[model samples]
Target: MTAALDVKGLTTRFETRAGHVTAVNDVSFAVQPGRIMGLVGESGSGKSVTGFSILGLIDAPGEVTAGAVLVDGVDLRQLSTEDLRKMRGRKVAMVFQDPMMTLNPVLRVGDQMTMAVRVHQPMSKSDALQHARKALEVVGIPSPAERLKAYPHQLSGGMRQRVAIAMALLHSPSVIIADEATTALDVSIQGQILAEVRELADETGAAIVWITHDLAVVSSLADDICVMYAGRIVERGTAEQVIGGPRHPYTQGLLDSIPARHEPGRKLPQIPGSTPQLSRLPEGCPFQPRCPRATDLCRTEPPLDVRDGQAVLCHHPLEGV
Candidate 1:
């Protein structure tokens, strides 16, 4: 079967006062149906920008300069505005970090959900309403019928996010890009939302791109993981492979920084230096300035290589199995 989503040589750039700034540089990955791909990185690492570009949501001075975002073999970049707009919510949807981005404070929850369903599907108001209610039930919302009459402001943060997720699932889109969708919620709530998302993907065979800075979250939810640094994906592999035995120095630093994984009484390891601004990015490896294992060769750009099913871009990758 065709991959649910495939992104090839994806590059997003912005025309800023300082000149062209690349936010997503040649990032590529694929998510199979019923699978979740986790995009992990630090702030300014361009993980979120990659997702936005794939959804054709990049605006203003920023645009996807090169790449093919294929949803079930149909290239999204090649579609016209009208066609892309139609395809967006029907074949692919995005769950944003903030639920307010998806919900209208002035509208009732039922209206927002049903409207989304009707916009993508040919159905009567009654049918759409029924679908909306069922979606709410599917996402574990309590009193689904009563909640539909409430406005977004009336619901708690977690509830609003659940409603937003329900809206995304309204049409059963084949692909969903979740950009830090659970970051703002409490731990329990975040887990609940993830479980719901996982269930939805399994039930509908929808491919999901889960973008976040939390390695722990990715470790639990993703079948595969991609680690980004300074706009480029520095490492990609199965969740177990990347999380258990990261090859790139940056990836190792990330794994070390996790508080829970640190040895008792030991200070958590942090990758030194901040992420370089896009306008002033270093000449060679962006992570070289902070990498503990950096050498003279690391000062030159390293090619991304595939070894043992893991893709790594580093001059001196970790040796041994």
Candidate 2:
């Protein structure tokens, strides 16, 4: 099947006083229609940068140096700024971590959504409002009509997030990039949103790029997983393959740190050393300094080892038990 979203050799860099820092390095992945691809990593792992790069949202000081962001076989990088802006909400959309980033605090939910609808489509205000109500309903928001009349601050965090998501779906975009969309909500609310997202994917045939640091979230919600470290993808596989049997040391360390994976009351295992500064990354594998399994071979660039459908960029990948 053709990918709804395909990213190839995505590289983004930042120009700092010290030097140029590569925030996203040769990252590549594809999400087929109705599938969710989890881009899981640590805070500075460039997963978020990848999301912004895909949407052409990278600003000054940080720029997407190379790559092709293809949505429905159209390369977004080839489009002009105006064209890209038009494509953003119509063919592809993004839900930011903070709902406020997408919502206007002063505007009523219905008014904002109506404006969003009319931005790309020439529609009457009443008709646009109807579309907004339907979108809210699609995200499982109750009393959609009433909720639309309320201001953003009047709703709870989860409700605000759902509204943001609903707004993203107003155009029926083929690709949706969600950057930590549910991180602020409580677990129960997060679970509820995840369920709704899964349903949205199935019903709308939209490919979702779920960017998060939480393996647990994606373990249940994603069809595929990509583990990133130091702006590079370290592993890629089906959710089952990556979570059940992580091959890369970095991936293993992340799973091991999850509380549920350990016995009660025991201290969790952690990958030693924090993420290296982008400008100061080591000569070869960036994770080598923290990897217990590292050897002389790890000091140089590691090979991409593929077994079954799982791929790990490591000289010594962990064997499945």
Candidate 3:
């Protein structure tokens, strides 16, 4: 079966004053309908850039130089700007980290959502409003009819985010790229949203790419996990495989370093050093400088070693599974 969203060898770069910085290099992944693929990594790992690149949201200095971002077998990179713009909301939707990115402070929540679908389809205002109300209800928003008339600022943070998600669902798009959308919410609210989002995908049959730095969240919310380092995917496998037995050193470090993994009175283990700057990344593996498994072979780039369907970019992959 064809994937709902397929990204192949996606390379996005920015020309900075220092030099060219590749934010996403030859990254590849596929997400089928009703499936959620977690793009997990630290800040500046290029996960957010990957999401923006997929939606044609990259700005002037940043550009997607190579590879394809396909939505239901249609390559978005091959489309014209106007065509891409048209595809964004109807065929693909993005739930940005900040609710304000999706909500216009000046516009009433109802009006904004109504405009979202109306632009994609020639629907009457009343029909659009009805559609918006139904979407809000679908996302578990209460008193949807009254919520629509209020401005974004009138709603609480969680409410605003729910409104944003409801807007994304308004079009029933084939794909949704949620770039750290729940990171800012309180823990309880975040969990509520995550559960709701998973249910939403199941109900709508839409593929979702959830980009986040929180592994604990992904371990529970995602079916598959792609651990990114310095713009490249260093590990990819089923969520349980990656979380239970991480082959890549970077993946291991991430799991080991999370606070929840530490026992009482024990400090959370931290990965040595920090993520490398994209412009000055080492010639070999980007994580080699910080990897404990580095060797002479690591000075050169490591091929993605495939074992039992799991892939790890490391000269010496970890053992035990």
Q: Looking at model 2, how many pairs of residues clash?
A: 0
- What is the C-alpha lDDT profile of model 2 across 10-93, one tens digit per residue? 999999998999999988888999999999998899999999999999999999999999999999999999999999999999
lDDT of each: 0.90, 0.92, 0.90
**Residue pairs in collision within model 3:** none
Candidate 3 backbone clash number: 0
Pairs of residues clashing in candidate 1: none
- Cα lDDT tens digits, model 3, 191-300, are 88998998998889999999999898899999999999999998999898899899998899888887777787798878888888888998687888888888877878
Candidate 3 regions exceeding 4 Å error are 302-308
Give model 1's TM-score versus the native structure: 0.97
Residue range 138-225, candidate 1, lDDT tens digits: 9999999999999999999999999988888887888999999999999999999999888887888999999999999999999999
TM-score of each: 0.97, 0.97, 0.97
User: Which runs in model 1 stand beyond 4 Å of their true positions?
Assistant: none
Candidate 2: list runs displaced more than 4 Å: 302-308
In lDDT terms, how accurate is model 1? 0.90
